[model samples]
Target: MSSRNSHSVLDLQSLTREQVGRIFSIADGYAGSDVSRLATKGCGKTGALLFFEASTRTRLSFETACARLGVHPLRLDGKAGTSLEKGETLEDTVLNVAAMNPDFLVIRCGDDLDLAALSSQVSMPILNAGWGKKGHPTQALLDAYTVRKYLGTCEKQKILIVGDVRHSRVAASHFELAKVLGYEVALCGPAEFLPEKPSVPVFSSLQEGLSWATVAMALRVQLERHETSYSLKDYRAAYGFTVENLKKLSAKALIMHPGPINQGTEMDSEVLQDPRCKVLPQVTSGVLIRQALIQLNCLEETL
Candidate 1:
């Protein structure tokens, strides 16, 4: 097993199964504790958060987590008031934020390489929220927690990742996490949108891929990144998991998606609302996981 203190989780590929389990345990501790009491006691407060990209769930969760731990969260949303609109470079923005003497810095940026670069320059602990096409470590951590919660253990489990893998940071993170946890990971999508040279198996057809898998992870197709004229109709025909396709999955298989789901584009609305789907739990776990990450990084620095 890899050492837990080795990295700041800029990428999911560096984390081992043991590290994932440890994160869950930490989350459990926070979950069991009384947040109101913690807020009153003010155990250990720290840092600010910087998000250079758009976010919904991640942004809110981190804010809530910091509040629960009595930490002051200073958020930058990249608007008129922020230095970014005034033509400041990413390096300068990060450096200026770090100069606040905050104990930790949580960043959600569009570039994965930039997050890694910023981590090296800063003295404070850095937590990656979501980076472009590379990885979302917190998302992966929560995903593993959800899977383990619903399916006992990940060992020998089969997981099918469908839809757009080529431009999905979530898919990349899931690939590494599933691999570490001993899950049989499979990628299924159109040949053009499929991941290139995946570490595990790849299936051209979603039906074939869903046959032996216990989990189905569907990713949204990023229209902004596409140069070709890829219509929703054509994309759905080739990659979308309709209600009919959902029936083909194993009865025990759980449906998952990293929202906001393009309902008709990547999956049918019915499929998302299916009884076997764990999408809501995934969202809830995201909050818990983000909270745990903040506490862990902050506690590490203090210790």
Candidate 2:
């Protein structure tokens, strides 16, 4: 593996499919293992987790992952003295943090921001916790890791990603990585929510995509990112995975959500508890995958 500074894992594009596979393998080892003892491997290193947007899972997962890997975590949420609050540029904030000489930086920002550009300004490895509407590479890695753990492999598996495609970082990241990993990917949502020239197959109806999917990945409706108004009732009637649509899924099909799930909007309330739902497993895989990522990026220069 390259030195952490030589290659930052800000997006899946920077990682080959082989590298990603290796990451999942490492994550697999961490799963169900005594992570507390494992934390000692990264002792003396520090990671800065700066989130410019509101987050629950992504922020907490990264902090927990850092702790489990024995890397001290410095957290900064969407509050006072951040770039926006202080009216300073993101580049400046990152450069300031770089000066502090943290081993790595994990950042989550609005989808509109360019995290890649921000990474370019820092010498230490930068891990994109989540980036505005464009990417959530780590989440994609964990999601893929979860799928592989349950289904044996990801190659050629049909995955239908539903909802808020135009604004979801997770959807964008998953779409890019899944295509690279040879998963048959399809998008389902309203025309406004779907991208005009998406690389993957775009379905007008959720039922059509669901029927073809081996994995139904539901994305939360990102109202915060919406430009125009949307009706909840209408959205649920059309795009949401209603109880009726839930029954349409194959018994073998797996269900997943990136979470902070808007129950009754993108999915039915009961679907959260469904036997086939792998939501909790996705959360578990997230911590392990992030730990693996931190371990890889926090390696000493001599190593």
Candidate 3:
């Protein structure tokens, strides 16, 4: 069952199904327990946060998990005093951090940076916060955890991911990991925004997707990544989850988005407030799942 803890968490691909199951089990425990119980799980341990990209939820979530687990959080802002400003290579910056001997390092950088190469250089565990447009494995983990909370089990649950799939790290991660975690996955978006050949079903419209899904996850339109300007009305007509289209969703279906939501664009305001929306639960589960990741990856223990 591979009970050994992960040496480095670059992506979910390295984790066995049993390891993933154990992580979810631990996270489930944290979700049900009071925050006070997590205070000393990583007592005297330390975690270094190195973010080259701007982030809100991922940065704060990891820091929050560190506090709850008695792990000290040290952040190196890419803009300020970091050596990257002074032409010190990322390799040197990583080397300096690794020399300090922190228990583990958490990082988020642009898509251009090679996380695999960075991991090869560091002896301690390197937890990938977001590796550009390639993947956000932890986000995928919490997402699956959140879905299981609402749907009882992930096995064969229909998960329809809607929006800019090509440039979204979360969407990419979910598309791959959701299948690994046992779900029937599908993608919906303008042809430009989707993969050329998807392993799962590809729906032309959001309405068609919602009709078949138990969970509808909206990916934020990656305007920053797109070179071609898209008409908002045309986008809405084609793929947006307007109130009218949201009505097509089954009553048991859940809605989701990896934060910093573009309220009126991808989905309407009312749908954001809908009880069936699991967005906030996904956020909440992020903290708990990260807590489990920190304990398992940074601390030596037998689960």
Q: lDDT per model, in order?
A: 0.77, 0.82, 0.84
Colliding pairs, model 1? none
Q: For residues 44-117, what per-residue lDDT tens digits would candidate 1 score against the true structure?
A: 55667787888888888888888887788888885558776888876798899888767678888876348776
Candidate 2 colliding pairs = 39-69, 39-70, 110-132, 111-132, 111-133
Summing lDDT over every window of 10 consecutive residues in candidate 2, give the lowest-scoring window. 294-303
The alpha-carbon deviation from the true structure for residue 7 of candidate 1, after best TM-score superposition, in angstroms, is 5.7
TM-score per candidate, chains pooled: 0.91, 0.94, 0.94
- Candidate that would win on TM-score: 3
Per-residue accuracy of model 2 over 1-303 as CA lDDT, tens digit each: 224576577778657788787788788888868866787887898988888778888899898998888889888887576666768766677778778988888888775667677666667888888887778999898889888988889998998989888877888788779767888888988877888788888988888888898999988887777788889899898888777887778888899999878988988888878888999999988888988888766664521
Question: Candidate 3: worst 10 consecutive residues by lDDT?
Answer: 1-10
- Model 2, which residues run further than 4 Å from truth? 1-3, 81-84, 111-113, 300-303
What order do candidates take by lDDT, descending?
3, 2, 1
Model 3, 1-303: lDDT tens digits are 123323678777667778889999989888888888778888888999998888888999999999999999989867577668889877678779988988889989886778788677777788889998888989999889988898898888998998888888887787678657778889998998898777778998678889999999888888878898887788877788778888889989899888778878888888878889888888899998889988887786543
Per-candidate clash tally: 0, 5, 0
lDDT, candidate 2, residue 272? 74
**In candidate 1, what residue range of length 10 has the lowest lDDT sum?**
1-10
Residue 194's C-alpha lDDT in candidate 3? 90
Clashes of 1: 0
